[model samples]
Target: MKYDVIVMGAGHNGLVAAAYLAKAGKRVLMLEAADEIGGATASVRAFKEYDALLSRYSYLVALLPDQIIQDLGLNFETISREVSSFTPYKKEGKDFGLHISRVWDKETEDSFIELTGSAHEGKAWQEFYSEVEKFAQKMAPTFLEPLRTRREMKTLIGQDSTWEYLVEKPMAEVIQSKFKDDLVRGVVLTDALIGTFASAQSIQSNICFLYHLMGNGTGEWKVPRGGMISLVNELERIVQSAGVEIRTDAEVTQVSTDSVGVRVQTKKGDSFTAEFLLSNAAPAHLDRIRGKKSESALSGSQIKINMLLRTLPRLKSGADSRRAFSGTFHINESYSELEDAYVTAAKGEIPKHAPSEMYCHTLSDPSILSEELAQQGYHTLTLFGLHTPAELFETDPESSKKIAVQRCIDALNSYLIDPLESVLAKNSDGSLCIETKSPLDLEKDVRLPGGNIFHRDLTFPFKEEGDAQIWGVETDDPRIFICGAGAQRGGGVSGIPGHNAAMAVLAKG
Candidate 1:
């Protein structure tokens, strides 16, 4: 069949592109390899015995633009978190932790002072975040518009020193120069390491740090009200209502482009042709399917663990368990510790002290659980372990996963009064309610090459020399475009690439 545009994947970005194209009065067809859409944004009944819906892959919402929600009239909603983060520490036979609240009050400041043993560090924390806020404000608006040159972006930032530190220098230097406390520096550097395998000392790490902070102009990672699936469900509705046809279990096998248009053939012997083709698959995956040589070296590093607990684990720090788990809970993720783990992982060994983060989704929104589960104090815990690269598991996938999961649990246990295993809920069959996914598992489940969550490592938002202006979704073939995380500024849940791809197609006239 022939169509105006053929979108090759049903990921969030592809759905966004298809929805916009269909709404613009074009006939669009979206094909998916899996039976359902959303790709990494899917929420599934991961533990059937517990009656809980876990965001199996992508867990938070921060990068999606408000303009897309308003333009599409999406029914999606996210709850703002009160506590921003809590990092626990052990000192001189006593347990203490630092808490950063959304509303920075005296308690937050006191916690920082106590943990760092310096009131100066507490003051520095405010100053550091204030600078980040300014950076977010300057860069957030550029995300929705066409790609700018480096010079243009620097002009918008308006401060030579700020641009030099944030954009020109390595992120490690910025964190070290600004924050005196190693733990505080770790907290700031964590933003640069999310899904990125590079060290904060690298220039690429600066790009990752900027992308993490530029979310929605606030850098606040909000929780979707119903779960990540709600966003996908709403986008599916918009696409269907706009008359876009969607086909699942349609694994595309080939994409051939000519001067006039493109042709797509699926493994099922079905064929499609369109004037324009949009690929939501990883650029490397698309190259493999299209019989072309791939150029990018992309891999994801992180271990994701989903658990259902009968109750919150008691923290040694004596903070309110609900408050501690409500936001990002850091485990052994201090600055020196993070650098050590990175160095260990680079040496192809899983860090003994795995730097990880955890949060209880039920603490913020219990809607994902059944009423009985909620009443029974059952909650969902999503833990993410950093610095465990995909290569660590290439030799023995199962053994590496087992070791990685146990190390993460052990790291979390050091901060808790009780071992994490003690509070885990059990199935009727006596199995603990826990699941772990390594980068290898993600590659198998979602086709994320090397399990890299942001596709290839993130790219700078500005255009480089010899690149197409405004849009970064263009490919070597004029009729073909990339609308997935591999594109420039195409990481996280943001629909910018999809939106921009459609805009590129519309501008072809």
Candidate 2:
């Protein structure tokens, strides 16, 4: 079959690209290797014994633009989280923790003061985030616009020192200089390390940090009204309405491009021809499928844990468990600990104390669970362990996953009054209601190429000299483009790559 354009994957980005192209009157066809769409931005009935729908891989919503939501008339909704994060600390024989909420109140201030033993650190915390808020506001709009150089962006930021500190220097330098408390610094630096293997000291770490903060212009991470699957289902509705044809389980075996157009061959011995091709697969994966050698260094560096809990675990810090688990419940993620974990993982060994984060999805959006489960006080917990690089599990993924899950549970247990196992829901067969996906598992499940969630190490959002201007989705082949997280400015559930790829194709006329 022939088409005006053929998208290589039906991931969220691919769906966004196809929707836009078809809306612009282009005949589009999308082929997905998996039976379902959304790629990592999907939800699943992971536990058969439970009635909860879990956002399997990509859990939260932040980077997706309001412009896309409005333009596509998407029927999706996100619930705002009142509490931003809660990090537990034990010192001076007291149960203390830092709780930052959407609004600054006396209780939050008191928590910081108690945890840090200084009002100055609390003041610095507010001042530091105020700067981040301003920076996010200035940079968020630029994401949807044409690419800008580092110089141009610096000028937009309007302060040489701020630009140098944030964009040019390592995130660690800025974080250390701005915040003195170890736990506070870690809370801020955690943004820099999500899905990235690099330490806070790495210059490249600043890019990851910046992306995490600039989502939606306010750095607010939100939960989908239902689950991540609803977001994908809405995009699918948009694309189908625009007359785009979609095929599943159609893995592309080879891609051939010529001066005129491109041809995509599937493993099922089917051929698809199109004037243009947009790939939602990782750049490295695309290279392999096209039988080309790729030198891209891409590897995922986090462990994802999905658990169905009978109830929220009681906290050792004496804070309300509901509030502690409402937002990001950080565990052993101090700045120094994060550094040590990075160093240990780089040596191909799991850190003695893993830095992880968890959140109760039901706390924010209880609609993901059925009425029976909600009445039963059941909740879903999504835990992510940082600095557990792909190398650590290379030798023995099965054993590594078991050890990693245990370490994460142990780390959480330190901050909890009752053990994590005590709150775990039982499966039909009487097993613990918990599942984990290592980087290797991500590679096998999503073809992420080294299990890197963002496809490859993230690049600067702007284009360099002699780079493609069509939304930074262009490749060496003019007839082909990238619409996945591997594309420039692509990561998370943003769908920026997809929208940009469609704009690139539309600009061809």
The lDDT of model 2 is 0.89
lDDT of 1 by residue, 436-478 (tens): 9999999999999899998787888998765765688888888
- The runs of at least 3 residues in candidate 2 whose Cα sits more than 4 Å from the true structure, single-residue gaps closed, are 466-469
Tens digits of per-residue lDDT, candidate 2, 1-509, equal 36999999999999999988999899999999998888998899899978899998999888999999998899999988889899988897767778988788888899888887789888888887778888878888888777887777777877677678878889988888888888999998899999999988897789898889888788889999899999999999999989999999999989998877899899999998999999999999898988889976748999999999998888888899998898998999999999999999998899989999999999989999999999999999999999998888988889998998899999999888989999999987889989899999999998888889999889878766666465778888888899999888998899899998888888887
lDDT of model number 1: 0.89
> Roughly what TM-score does model 1 have, to 2 decimal places?
0.98
Report the poorest 10 consecutive residues by lDDT, candidate 1. 463-472
Query: In model 1, what lDDT does residue 124 have?
Result: 79
